[model samples]
Target: MKILVTGGAGFIASHIVDAYIQAGHEVTVLDNLVTGKKENINPKAVFYHLDIQDAQVVDIFAKHRFDLVNHHAAQMDVRRSVEDPVYDARNNVLGMLNILQACVKTGVQRFIFASSGGAVYGEQVTFPADERHQTQPYSPYGITKLVGEKYLFFYALTYQLGYTILRYANVYGPRQNPHGEAGVVAIFCRRLLDGQQPIIFGNGEQTRDFVYVKDVVTANVKALDRKDNEILNIGTSTETTINEVYEHLNALIGAGMAQKHGPAKEGEQFRSVIDYGYAKKVLDWQPQYDLQTGLKETVAYFQ
Candidate 1:
C-alpha cells in the first residue's frame, strides 16, 4: 500500500512512517519543516517539503493516488492557540479541510488522523475519559482538533471515506522535541541530564497519561489493517502527575535536582487520563510501555 503521512518529519509521525515502511508499504512524507525536523524524514520516503495548506497537496494526492493518509500536521501549541486563535485555525482547521478535500478528489480510502486526548477533553468529569465523554475543549488548539474530527466524520458519511481518528495522550519518547508544549518529560530529562534546574508549573500536581511513541506507532499499524471507521483513545489509562514524572526521571537518571515551581499556563488541564476500552475491544490495541520504561528509553535516546 502507498501511504502519505503529513508531518512525516515530526517526532510522532516519523515513528509512524518508519512503522509503515517496515510493514513493506511505499511511503511519502509531506512536511513544511515548521515544527518537523528534516533529519527525522525517512530517506526512503518520497519527501515533499511543502505546507499542507497549499494547493500543491491536492496535486500530490492526484499524482500518488495514496491508499491512506495519516494526517499529523497541526499547530500543536495550546498557549499559541490562546494567543492567536486565527493563526491556529489557519494551520490546523484550514489545513485539515485541505487534506479532506484532497482525499475526496483523489478517492483515498483511509485517513488516520492524530487527534489530541490531552487537550480535547478539557477538565475531565470522570477519572479515565472515554470516547463518549463530554468534550469541552478549553483552548483553540483543542477546538481545532475536535473540528477536524467532525470533518473526518463528514467525509466518511458523505464521501464514503474511511477514517480512524486516534486521540492520543501525552506522547513522548525518542525524537520528541523537549522545547514544545506537552514535552514535560523530554524537557525534564534534558534539564536533568544537563544539570540545570527544571521549572514545574502549578505545584507539579498537574497530571497526564504519558504514552510512548513506539506504542502509538503500533496503534497506527493496527489501525491500517482495521476495517471499521472509528474513534479510538490511545493511552495507558493511568495518570502520572508532573512531580511524580520528575522524580521518576530524576531517579532513573541518578539526579537529585529539585524542580522549580512557577505559575501554571492558562488553559492547561489539571489532570487527564483516557480510557481505552473501545480501542482494546475494536482495534485490539494496548499500550506496551509504562512511564518508567519509556522514560529510561527516552533518556538513552538523548545519551
Candidate 2:
C-alpha cells in the first residue's frame, strides 16, 4: 500500500513512518519542518517539505494516487492554542481540510487520524473516559481535534471515505521533543539528564495517561487493514501523576534532582486518563510498555 504520512518528521509520526516502511509499504512524508525535525524523517520514505495547507499538496496526491493518508500534522500545543485560536484553527482545522480535499480529489481510500484523548475529554467526569465519553474540549486545540473527527465523519458519509480516529493519550518515547510544552516526559528526562531540577506544576498531582510511541505506531499499522469507520481511544487505562513521572525519570536517569514547584498553568486538565478497552477489542492492541519501562527507555535515549 502507498501511504502518505503527514508530520512524518515529528516524534510520533516519524516512528510510525519507520514502522510502515518496515512492514513493506511504500511511504511518502509531508512535513513543514515547523515543529518537525528533518533528522527524524526516514530515508526510505519520499519527503515533501511543505505544509498540509499548501496547494501543491493536491499535486502530490494526484500524482501519487495515495491509498491512505495518516494525518498527524497539527498545532499540538494547548497553551499556544489558548493564546491564538485563529492560528490553531488555521493549522489544525483548515490544514486538515486541505488534506481531506486532496484525499477526496485523488480517490484516497482511508484516513487514519491522530486525535487527542486528554484534551478532548476536558475535565472528565469519568476516571477513565472511553470512546463513548462526552466531549467537552477545554482549549481551542482540543476543540479542533474534536472538529477534525467530525469532519472525518462527514467525509465518510458524503464521499464514502473510510477513517479511523485514534484518540491518543499523552504519547512519550524516544524522538519526543523535550523543548515542547506538550511532552512532560521528554522535558523532565532532558532536564534531569542535564542535572537541572525538573519543575512540577500544581503540587504535582495532575495526572495523564502516557502511552509509548511504539504502541501508537502499532495501532496505526492495524488501522490500515481495519474496515471500521470508528473512533477509538488509544491509551492505558491507568493514570499516573506528574510527581510520579518525575520520580520515575529521576531514578532512571540517576540525576537525583530535587522537586521544584511552579504555578500550574490555568486551563490545564488536572486529571486525564482514557480507557482503551474498545481499542483492544477492535484493533487487538494493548499498551506494551508500562510507565517505568517506558521511562527507562526514554532516559536511555536522552543519555
Candidate 3:
C-alpha cells in the first residue's frame, strides 16, 4: 500500500513513517517544518516540504494516487490556540479540509487521523473517558480536533471514504521535541539533561495518560487493514501524576534536580486518562511500554 503521512517529520508521525516502511509499504511524507524537524523524516520515504493547505497538495495526490492518508499535522499548541484561534483553525481545520478534498478527488481509500484524548474530553466526567464519553472540548485546539473528526465522519458518509480516528493519550518517546509547550516528558528530560530544574505547573498532582510513540505507530499500522469506520482511544487507561513523571525521569537520568512548581496554566485539565478497550478489541492493540520502561528509553535517547 502507498501511504502519505502528513507531519511525518515530527516526533510521532516520523516513527509511524519508519514502521510503515518496515512493513513493506511505500511511504511519502508531507511536513512544513513549522514544528517538525527535517532530521526526523525517514530517508526511505518520499519527502514533500509543503504545508497541508497548499494547493499543490492536490498535485501530489494526483501524482502519487495515495491509498491512505495518515494525518498528524496541526497547530498542536493549546496555549497558542487560545491566543490566536484563527491561526489554529486555518492550519488544523482548513488545512485538513484541503487534504480531504484531495483525498476525495484522487480516490484515496482510507484516512487515519491522529486525534487528542486529553484535550477532546476536556475535564472528563469519567476517570478514564471512552469513545462514548461526551465531548466538550475546553480549548480551541481540542475543538479543532473534534472538528477534524466530524469532518472525517462527513466524508465517510457522503464520499464513502473509510477513516479511523485514533484519539491518542499524551504520547512521549524518543525524538519528541523538548522545546515545545507540549511534550512534557521531552521537556522534562531536556531540562534535566541541561542541568536545569524542570518546572511543574500547579501543585504537580495533575495527572495524564502517557502512551509510548511506538504503541501509537502500531495502531496506525493496524488501521490500514481495518475497514470499519471507527473512533478509538489509544491510551493505557492509567493515570500518572506530573511529579511522578519527573521523579521517574530524574531517576533514569540521575540529574538529582529538585522539583519546581509554578502557577498552573488556566484551562488545564486536572486529570486526563482514556480507555483503550475499544482499540484493543477492534485493532488487537495494547500499550506495550510501562511508564518506567518508556521513560528509561526516552532518557537513553536524550543522553
TM, every model: 0.98, 0.99, 0.99
lDDT of 3 at 213: 89
- Mark the regions of model 1 whose C-alpha exceeds 4 Å error after superposition: none
Positional deviation of 33 in candidate 1, in angstroms?
0.4
Candidate 2 C-alpha error for residue 262, in Å = 0.8
* lDDT (10s digit) by residue, model 3, range 1-303: 999999999999999999999999999999999999999998999999999999999999999999999999999999999999999999999999999999999999999999999889989999899999999999999999999999999999999889999999999999998999999999999999999988899999999999998889999999999757899999999999999999998888889888999999998989999999999998999999999888889999998
Model 2 TM-score?
0.99
Count the clashes in each prediction: 0, 0, 0
Q: Candidate 3, TM-score vs. the true structure?
A: 0.99
How far residue 118's Cα lies from its native spot in candidate 1, in Å, is 1.1
Write the residue-wise lDDT of candidate 1 on 1-303 in tens digits.
999999999989999999899899999999999999999988889999999999889999999999999999998888989999999999999988998999999899899999999888899999899998999999999999999999988888999999899999999999988877658888888889988888999888988999999999999999997546799999999999999999998899888887789988866889899998889999999998888899999999987
**Best-to-worst lDDT order:** 3, 2, 1
lDDT of 3 at 58: 98
Q: Name the lDDT of candidate 3.
A: 0.95
